[model samples]
Target: MSLDLAWRLLKGGGRKGLLSTWLTLGAVAVSTALLLFAVAVNFAFTARGERGAWRNPVPAASGAVAVEAARFDYVGDKEITVVDLAALKGDAPAPPGLPRFPAPGEVWLSPALAELAGELPADQLAGRYPDPKGVLGDEALVHPGELVAVVGHKADSPVMTAARSQDWIVGKGPVEVASLAGTPSEDSEAYRALTLVASVLMVVPLLVFGGAAARLTVARRDQRLAALRLIGATPGQVVRMTVAEAVIVALAGALLGAAVYAAAAPLLAGIAIGGGPWFVSDVLPGPLVLAVVLVAVPLLVGLSAVAGLRRVVVSPLGVAKRETPPAMRFVRVLALLAALAVFPLLSRGSSVGIVAVALGLAFLCVNLAGPWVVGLIGRVTAGTARKPARLLAGRRLVDDPRAAWRTVSGVALTGFVAGFLGLLSPSAFGDGQESAQLRIAAPVEQAEAVAGQARDRLREAGVTATVRVSKEERGQNRLVAVALGSHAGTPTVDRARTALAGLVPGHTPTTQADDQRFGLQLLADVRVGTIVVLSVSFLVAVASSGITAMSSILDRRQTYGLLRLAGTPLEVLDRARRAETLIPLSVMGGGAILTGVFCALPFMAGGVSTAGLVTLVTCVVAGFAGVIGAGALSRPLLRSVTADPAPRPD
Candidate 1:
């Protein structure tokens, strides 16, 4: 019986209900699709290194085989994950998760690296890999590009001998490498932090859009539910009915999103994750992920609906009274100021965790502060307005600033992202042509300990620095071992030495601009992913904002026509629509840009970043352009509303 009532209520909403439902579904679907896509891609990257289980067969006399262990160490000139292949049909079967084995002179590339091999010129390969030939194939062992190539040398070969002696190698001695396991590869701690940062960029606006869409036609919903309550329906029943409506819309959206994801997966399959394009099979998640998405999306949407219905739930009588909303808090602006104040703490780009956390905070704060800015704009516009249309638009905004802000919140967030991006743009790294080296004057026996100490200390110093060991045994074979590294600032070097004082004896120090090039390589990949995420988020933002604008215009159709019939000019109504959209957008959008810059300023090497400046300018220009465009778009609606000055019944 409740279900029938809920359905009838939705059906009775007519055009308004249908539009709201469509908008809500679209918001949910976009959010779901983006989330699923993000999960799928993360899996594609992170799972590249996880092997099931495999053990050493040489030591397998009568006991169970142990899984092979692989680790990444020495990241400067060349950092590689070494694997042991002793199972050679003697000790035990091949390593459980061995993707494939390369011959003694051959190397297998990860999907990402294979793509690189195909795309990059031969010269670039030579610079990264000396010989660069003997390419083979491996699925579960490498992290794209030249990271996980297997060598066929015996456990005691000179090549394996040198690798085992490195400070970063975890194992004591070189073992026969049956096959290279892919588990445990790159996407460093810094990388995960980056992922978090990226997810926030895409996910926040999604939450906002989804929430906003869920509450579309709040006034209408509240009034209808209040009438139901007055008719002796219990609050619980009314709540249940509203919730039922929310669930239906959410479920429909989730399904639509899933369909969109399924259709989009194949297209994304070709996007290179590590070094090569991921396979189509890897682009979609398992049944478990799908199940979670199905359940969670509707739950979130329903919750949003419930939150919006809070007013009605508390006092059903309020729905009929048209009470003014509480003024938007001025404290929201403090969030942006606080973010700016803390940004300069990130100057040297030393801490990835700090960087990611700070950026995330800045993004969030700017959004929180957006509404206050809208209210301010409304006040100012209303105060200064001389024209009737402008005055009406300003008054409406002053009357409901939260709604005014919501209409363009997406664009505001986008502007903030743009401001943030300008600060951290890849171009800031210059040509990324800097190179670095680390020379160790320690005995071969002490090399490993010294390297280990260096890394541990570097970690303490909050730097994601990678250390490299020499491939050749020439310089490092005797008392003086050579460990190469790139781009360590003086402070990082000093800290490393202090930590290595009693542990290992060695002195190695150097910082070159080119080392930033290596850093850029990592950031470049991350940048690509970030761009994709932001682009999607922006589209969703624009669409959602546009939907709200259209809905607002439609909802006020009668008021607009009445004013036209009374004394106001059609042009004035048109101007009012333009003013309402333009004023709040320009104000909030500007605030977002400033907030973004403030948050990003600290991470920026210098106070001013060219990219950020460009971004700020672009946002301003774009915001103004958007206002003009919005005004132009709203003119026709104004004309139609004024055409029949008489009130029309639904």
Candidate 2:
């Protein structure tokens, strides 16, 4: 009986109620889709990590099946992962992505590398390896376009024991491996941590938006539910009816959202991170995660809907008389303060898990304090009002701060995200060494001999350069340097690198950019990630502000109508509406930004960079513009509601 009544009411709310229902559904859809996309990033990184782990072989103490060594090689600017392997026993299992262990003089390249090799000249790239005997399988590569080569060599090859100048640069020397199973690389782990952090930044805002969906059209729903109570509907009946209505709409929305994400997964695979774009499979949160989202979103929405009924359930008479609820407590602000205080203390050198928890708590605390700050702003606005619109706006704020907060909360939280990432975004490192220098590491005893070879190679290649052997603190060996002339550039660098490729046995010749390539790539990725995070945050902010603004008008249509009938000008009502959002948004948005900056301070080793300052200012300007634009878009709705002053059954 309750379910039947719920259905009737849901279908009978006329056009405005129907519009509210569709708006709520759309909000849920947006929230669910964004949530899935955010979660997919962590999973994608994990997949990439696992796929590439076999390259970092774990040594076996005894009964070893194969000997393996891996190093990074470059063609132009592209990085190629080269793995050399030799079999100790006939039954040695092939490393991942091969039909069988390669025979001596045989080389296998990934599909991408094979294609690349065909396009480049033999001396530049393909000549570095034996002619390709086969293409590597997907299991041997991290992403679809990864460059990898597996070359079979004699066990006694000099490459096996060549000195690895740096573990990160030259890769580890050959080790006897029993199995291909290995752990994720340090770079992979770092990326995973970063993706997780990005998820939290995105997901928290998505959740807050989702919860706000349940409260859409609260005033009208509360009135109808309260009247039912006043006419003898049991509390259980009311609760059941509310749950049925909210959960059903939410479930439909959740399913639609999951479909949207699934459809967009192929497109999302193109977002480059950690060296390359993703495989389609990597970007999908699997069926288990999909099931969880479909179930959990509706449950959350239902609970939030029920929680908003305290007034309707506890005091129907008061709701009927349209009395204001008590102001939110100051404790909410303290909660935010406490969260901000704890973050810096826990941030430095703490594990990723700890930092994540602190950030999550801080993110949620921003949401918690937003309404209380809005209430305070309302009180101040009302006390200082000097005009009709100001008085109306102030009265609205004091009357229902939570509603006003909902309209601006997305922007406030985005401000927090912007400030946090903006402060940590990296700037370009100093430009050092004007001349291009190519270098290779050699044993201290062999340094002079390698230096002699380097000079000869550069001369034969017609490259203008000076050669020297120098010792750096980072390595135990001496480095043979080929310092090129002022006019030397990419083609000269490549020729020089190829000429000296085998000069040092294990270590490849490296340019200054190659020496610092990993660090530079990491910095570049951070900047890209910052842009992505901020872009998504702004989108959510705009959607929430716009949708909630329109919903607020729908929720308060009767009030706007009454005001119009009482001779309030349309211009005054519109000004009041804008002031209601603008006042609290300024206060809460600024506060959230400060809180975010405070949280990020512990990581600011050299203080804020110029790029960071620019990001902050840009976010502030964009955020204000987005919110104000959302308000402007809803002005027509405001005008429409006031155009008809008479009340309807809905």
Candidate 3:
């Protein structure tokens, strides 16, 4: 009976309720799309990393063609990775318009590499590759960041046999596809773990937003449910009715989200992972993952609704009269301190995976206690409010602190993530060069002149350093120089770099600690990953901010009308609404950021980079600004609600 009544009520919801339902649906859909896309991208990256592992021993349809795959740092600096042409082929047959196999020493470069190297073949006159006329052709590649060239070799050649094979089998393979899933390398494991944590942080708030959307007009719902209580409906019956409504809405929203994800798959497939754009076929989750998401979202939504509606279930009179909720205590602030203590311990000896998991746990604790902290902040704000608008907003928050917090908690949490990510990515290679060894690579003919110019530049820029020609690799000559105290940026390194760029054909002077380009690329990758998640979180925050604020205004129509009747100008009420949104936003966001910085402190012992800190603050500010804009957009609703005073029943 309760379920039937719930469905009837839902179908009869007026236009406003219908609109809220759609907003809820969109929030859930967006969240679902993000989660599935994250999973798909992870799978794609892992598959590409394990590219050769599967095709190494494949079944033969009679006999299958096999090709070798070898990856090398094209320029010794790891600026880009180059694979032999056969590497991209996997177990596939020879591609049309290309040689079935190249004679020994022939190679193909990716367009990006060819562009960087001025279309030169693998061998002649470039920094590396060691041979000229060895370059065969160029091809566009996809799926990873910088796999830039492919050297080809004849089938069954001695060199080819020694190399690993990665051709996706065109014919049947001896090994089962299912058996080829290998454990990822430690690096990949750590990366995926971090990515998963970011995804969790992003999705959690969306889930919260969707729940809020479903229960939009909570005050109205509470009033109605209380009347149901007054009329002798059992508490269990009322609870079931509310849960049923939330579950049905959530289930519908989750399905809509799955559709949203499917529609967004093509866009996601284009994201670069290993060395190229992911194959579209690799960008969808398996059935198991889909099933879990679909089943779990509704159950989670239902439970949250039950928890939120407890006030109505317990006492009809209390809810109907708009009783104030219990004030939150200061203990909620301890979660941040606890997290601060854990981070230092984590920095000392924990693995990246463990650290990420612990960080996630700490975030959860903060989120759970966020409302309490927000409530305590309300008391502070009320005590401090001097302006009429500020005082009224503070009083509203004091009346229902959880409701106030929900308006901006999404923004607050994003700030928290931003802070955590700020110091989280230092040189993956570690800090302090210990020795500022500048590695110089130039043509054999220009080696001495380049070394001389490098030394002269260094001398001109600052204090002392020594320069020496290092060694020859292939056709290029090399030199190494050691400089004093430059793990921190130095003008000498900058000047030397300028001199080298003028001398070397492709000016890339590297450092000993900088080693290969891997560290820089890895840092870029980490930032990109964080940005992707943060962007989505920001969008969720803004959308929920507007929708929930509008819902709250509609639910509080009578209260606002009474305030107007009591001679509060609409302008003052409007300012109060803005204050209500911005106060918790600024306070909680600031706390969240502080908590994030505390979490990041141990690893950034030398202190956070000025650039990093500035970037994070800018991002957090931009996010809050967006939320504030959303709140502003909902002002018309407030005007409409408070336009006329409605008499209350005695």
Candidate 4:
């Protein structure tokens, strides 16, 4: 409990201890920083979304109305059904005297829709703005020359006339229509998806740092703890002391992390929203309160105490001598089994599959096979090495495979998560179908003519198109079709639609088809980002593992020194250690890859193909190689341990 004694003990572990502590701190720092950013962004966006909803709620009749339109081609296919505003109003319909339909050639525009189209150029606009005729192509429902009125729904003001002019062409319709309602208050699907991604990313580094800290606390301090026991210190006292040290370190790291997050919150918010705080209110203090309670405090306290507390309760004498309790092994076994069982459930087609695989692999590699793998690899490599330095490296690895593997595991897990998440970039999904807009003419005969012309034009452009027709209540119409082609730029479906519209003398086509160019661009960006993040994360993991392993090697200096005196060259010793680590790394790496891919198979099967499988395999191989290379590089650390003639008692 003496400050002087604790400081001296802390300083005595030499370079190994110093390096290990720094590594732990660095890992903790990086993990906490990234986690903070992710959490902050998530909260900021969520808050903005919520406020945007409150400021612009959907009108009572907003959900009921829909626009019905035909396909772009002469085949007269049905495309989309715009929301039905009439049904939504029900008993509270617009003044009873109000016309049920807009006067022929005239239409109503919602304030939200008006704002969206306000900036569009008149020449570029294809048809009347905001009218059901423009949106649903219902020519009969609209009267010619009737005044177009812009009505505000769910806004502070009832009606604010927009400065933008309407583009009401006599024959064709607008290419797309804006929704009468504002963005939805809640997108549960998107929230759940982001949460899954964020949780996986956050937990990876937490486990790495926590495990490393725990191992270091128990491993590096064993000799000192053993010496204290010899001086009549009780096991409980030693354990308590170790726990106290961990508490101090965890607390310091956590508090520093939280402070860093708070100071950078503004910057973080900007990144999340893509500009200045968009939905934030200066008058409201609730977000600030929520940030602290929901994000900062819990992260610090939970990460700081979880690992260290467990390590502290163990008997120092036993721990120092490397006599970890049998229960720990049992726990490891149970964890491995649990991970194995959960792997299939995760891989079979859920977003949570990635997290399950990451966690499962961490448990198996770091907690279960670490020591055994390190020792086995070290021993085998030592047998083959001719160089004295290399042999010593092997022996160092073999002498304490567990510590070596622990280092490898930490780095490997970090890399795996980074790579996996990087590869599945959100952009890779492309703007889903939700964002695309499709529009067509109203009259069945006109729609059919437009569809045929579109088909002919697309065929000339070397695209194949199929169109289906359908009718709605009281003469509403639509067209649906899938187009195929090998054009390099825009999707063939979109190109065909455009060409078809041009062929119709007086009609224009409006539809949301795949934008091949945009899709490709998004894919490319995601691929690049994934590669970069994965590579950097992997390298960091590798370096941390090697350093930690070398530190472990140094801790067993006396043991290695005795082995040397017993005619074991430093080369053989180091080789043994390398062999021990290699086996587990390979096993765990393979297992992780298989498990991850297996878990992702169900979801990926629908979209990703054999190519994605290859990509994943490549990632795993690169990750494994990086870890092994790091272990190999730690040989120099072993050379520093002097070979002494005296033998030490086991």
Candidate 5:
């Protein structure tokens, strides 16, 4: 019997039931898939790192030798003493066989060292070699100075060429030697942090899509559940039947979504790296996990539906009558009080101020004022609506005021979060002004010359700039820092820096921008796009719920007619409908906004501000008014009650 009844309900609901269920399933599927994809990427990266595939290759001898210096001076008159190969190995090669110490008064160079020497003239290169005794332990190579010649793994040799050098050395013995011990790859803390952030981002799309579907399903079917009760079905049976139907729909949608994600996984991976092609073996494990999420998401959504069924069951009578209590009054009051108390803290630059203001405004607009606003608009607009459709809408709002607010809450919350966070994060905007120390790459010998040239160029361009040269702690590379005028735009700064970087003799220059600007821009884009999506979703839900509610009301027109004949005025009947809408709208709007605010508080406490608060509130209120106005104008459908003279005997 239950199966038969469930089937009947599914068939009756048809497209509407199927759409709502699939939408919910899609939400879950998308969210879970993303989570899975992230996991897979992490796994792939870990596996790659374990293999030591991404490391620099060096000769085996270098790994065994450790050169140390006392009180190492990077820029001062300190020197590196290289250990003798024979001493380190405890074995000496025959005199005539291996050329020891680069044929006396000479030095052996690594591929990197050879490349640096090649950059200078042959005459200049002679002086560039470090004192042979200072580096090697034996002064014999330096004392004789027998035409000091440096022997290195050949520069043009296939395996020993420098990374930055274009030329290669030919005719080489033992072109490259493998290091005796491989260095372990270092773990990236940043990558781990990004993975966590990506995982968190996955939740947003899930909640957004799933919550939207759930709310729409409940709103649209309230009247249907009420009718079921009137026809001798228990509320429990009605709730169970609805849940069963939702589960079926969700499962089908989830399966479909999974299939889509699996097929598209490769494409998504390719896009991740600037749309470059990637091999199947290189594909991250994340997409595969997303495929699994497809099924799991549907099941979870089904569970969520079951959780919400109680609300539909206990209120069938109220559903038919369009009655329910306003939502979150106490919570809203608390939010407002918290907002007031925290206002002072904000003035003191306490980060908590952002949270207090965001919560207070969200509560005031979404919860407290939402229903009343809907009701007022419905009443005022009902009289002005000339079209039958418009009049019918107005009348519906007048009958059930709370329902209007429920429809607008989802979109409002999405907008609020986006706007609030986007404005404060500097990286979100691409301004990149947060780093304390700057590094510029250039040749050691030409470091000062490059700085001077950069200063001259900037001055010629009517921009003041400061330049400083410093050596790296390891004495590996010379660095230059250029401080441009405060008024320089990012593009200007970038251009100037790029031009100046070219003047540096043998070093590549790279710039790091502030992270805050990137974050802010990302948030802003999300806010605008999500709001549009929310708006469309809300409109669909409202239209579906409103039509369903109106149909039920029309079915009971005779009841309304009899009440009118029994001396109830049209105004009172209108108030009753308005009150019905008021209840649901208030509950949904208040709950949604309060929940949104509560969720956003932690982010605000972290640094998001309240400048966008008024805008968010205004948008929410406007949306509510528009929805209510449409409902109020729907009143002409109720004209049938006044048109008929006699009441039907029930």
Candidate 6:
């Protein structure tokens, strides 16, 4: 019977009511889709970590089946991950992506590496490794374009010896492995951690947007429920009806959102992070996650819808009389202040889960403080207003601060995102082409012999480089520096490095430029990721503001009609609407931005960057522009709502 009544009430809502329903659903859909995308990052990185885990071999306790060592090699500007393997027994299990254990002298290259090897001269790129017998399967590579190679050698090979490893490099030492399964490398873990942080930055806003959907047509819902309360309806029944309506719409929206995410997964896979684009399969949130989102979203929307009914449930008369609620207290601001205060005190070395939770808490606190700040801004606006529009706008704000906050909350939260990410400037590592010197570490015993061999190799490869041998300490390995001539370029550097590859049994020749590339790539990725995150955030902000603006018109049409009947000009009401949004938006958005900047202070020990400053300025301007544009789009709706200033039956 309740479901039947809920359905009737839904259908009884006229065109305007139905529009509100649709808008609520759309808001849910967008929020759900964005939420799924945010969560996908955690899963994608985890998958990548797993796929690449074999290269980060774990040492066997006693029953060792194989010996392995891994190192990063460079071909021009590109980094190649090289893993050398030697089987202890014929029955040793083949690593992931290999059909069987590699025999001595066998080599396998990932497709990208094979392609690269084919494109370059044999001596420049391919000479270091034996010709590839086969390509590595997808399971062995983190991404499709990852450059990786696996080489097989005899157990007695020097490359598989403990002496071939460097203490500073993770997974570089040869370890006897019972099996290829291992943990993610530090590099992979760093990427996962970063993705987790980025997800927090994204997910909080999405959750807010989802919750806000339930309150889309709050005025209308309150009025309808108040009417039922006066007509002998029980609060429980009214709550059930509200929940039924909100959950029904939300469930539909959530399903739609899941569908949308599924469709966009392929496109989203194109976004490059951690030096490569994700595999499409990696970015997919599996069936369980999708189901969880669908169920959770509707429950959230229903609960949010019910929570707003306190006034109606307790005193329908007050809601019907449209009395101004008590003004919000100053204490609301304390949550945000407390969050910001604790954020910096937490050490950078705190666990990732702890930091992520702190960030999420701080993010939510911004929302908690938003409405109170909006009320204050309204009071100031009303006290200082010289015009009727501004005065009306201010009074409306004081009357319903939560509604006003809802209208501006999207952009205000966006301000937090902008300020937090905008100030993050990746450290400047200069362009990698400045240096032409290649450095290789060689045993002191073989320094002269390697230097002579290096000169011969360079000469034979038609490369002009002067070889110098130096040592920083008495017992340390000798350093072989190949200073390339002025005319030497990428090809020349590659040839020089290749010619000297075997000069040291386990060490790869590297340039200062080569070492800086990792930092450069990481920073570049951060910048790009910042742009993508901000763009998505702004889109949500704009969409939320626009949809909520129109919904606000539906909510207030009767009041608008009465005002029109009292000779209030439509232009004044329109201006008031604009003022109501812009005034609170300015206060709350600016405060949120500052709060975000405060939260970012600990991470900014290196100081601000020019790019970061520029990002902040751009965000401020763009945020304001987006809100204004959303307000403008709703003007026609306002005009329509007040077209006939006559009260009508539902």
Provide TM-scores for the models.
0.72, 0.97, 0.74, 0.59, 0.46, 0.97
Candidate 6: TM-score?
0.97
Worst 10 residues of 4 by lDDT: 156-165
TM-score of 5: 0.46
Candidate models: Cα lDDT each: 0.59, 0.85, 0.63, 0.45, 0.44, 0.86
Which 10 consecutive positions of candidate 2 have the poorest summed lDDT? 426-435
| Residue lDDT tens for model 6, 319-344 | 88887777777777888788788876
Q: Write the per-residue lDDT of candidate 3 for residues 557-633, one digit (tens) a residue.
A: 78888999999999999998888888788888888888877777765745566657766877777887898899888
C-alpha RMSD values across all candidates = 9.9, 1.7, 9.1, 10.9, 14.8, 1.8
lDDT tens per residue, model 2, 1-650: 88888889989988888989988998899899998888878888998899888888888988888888888877677788888888888888877899999877799999999998888766567767647999998888898899998988777777776657775777865888887776788889999988888889999999999999999989989989989999998888989999999998899899898889889989888888788888899989999988998898999999999999888889987887788888788898899888888875764587888778888989888898888888878889999999999889988998999999999999899999988889897655634332378778888888898888888877887767899987663477877778887687666777777778778766777777776677777877898888888888888888899999999999899999988888999999999999999999898889889888888888776678888889889999999999999999999989888878997664
Badly placed stretches (over 4 Å) of model 3 are: 52-69, 73-187, 273-276, 329-331, 334-336, 427-515, 648-650
Q: Candidate 2, clashing residue pairs?
A: none
Identify the superior model by TM-score, candidate 2 or candidate 3: 2
lDDT of model number 5: 0.44
Residues 1-650 of candidate 5 have per-residue lDDT tens digits of 65577768766755535544444555444444444454455554444333322121233444322111001000011111121121123222211112442333344543323443455433223233444322221121211111212222222332222122111111111212232122322222333333343333333433444433444446556667668777888866876776666666666655664566567667654532211223334444554565566555655665666665565576666766657533423454455456445433443233333544444454344434544555665766677766544465566556554445444433444443333333333222444443322345555666688678777866765555677886552144466777665665544454453354325322223334422322443454445433433443344334433443444344456667876787766766666565445444554545555455454444453354344455456545655665566457547656655567496442
In terms of TM-score, which candidate is stronger, 3 or 5? 3
Candidate No. with top lDDT: 6
Candidate 4 structure quality by residue, lDDT tens digits, 1-650: 64445556656756656765555555455445545544444555455444323112243333433221111121112121112121223233231113443332344542323333354432222122334333221121111111223221321111111111121221112111122223422332354344545445545555455446445534446666666776787655665556555545554555566666566555433322111222223212245653553344334434443344333345544555555333223455455556556545554345555654555464344346445545655767678877765566566566555565566665445444543453353334443332223344434555566556655665776656564443531223344333342332234334444455434322334433322323443454445434534554554566556656666665676767777777886667766566555555666566544544443443343455444545566667777677678777768767766444465452
Q: Residue 155 in candidate 1 has what lDDT?
A: 39
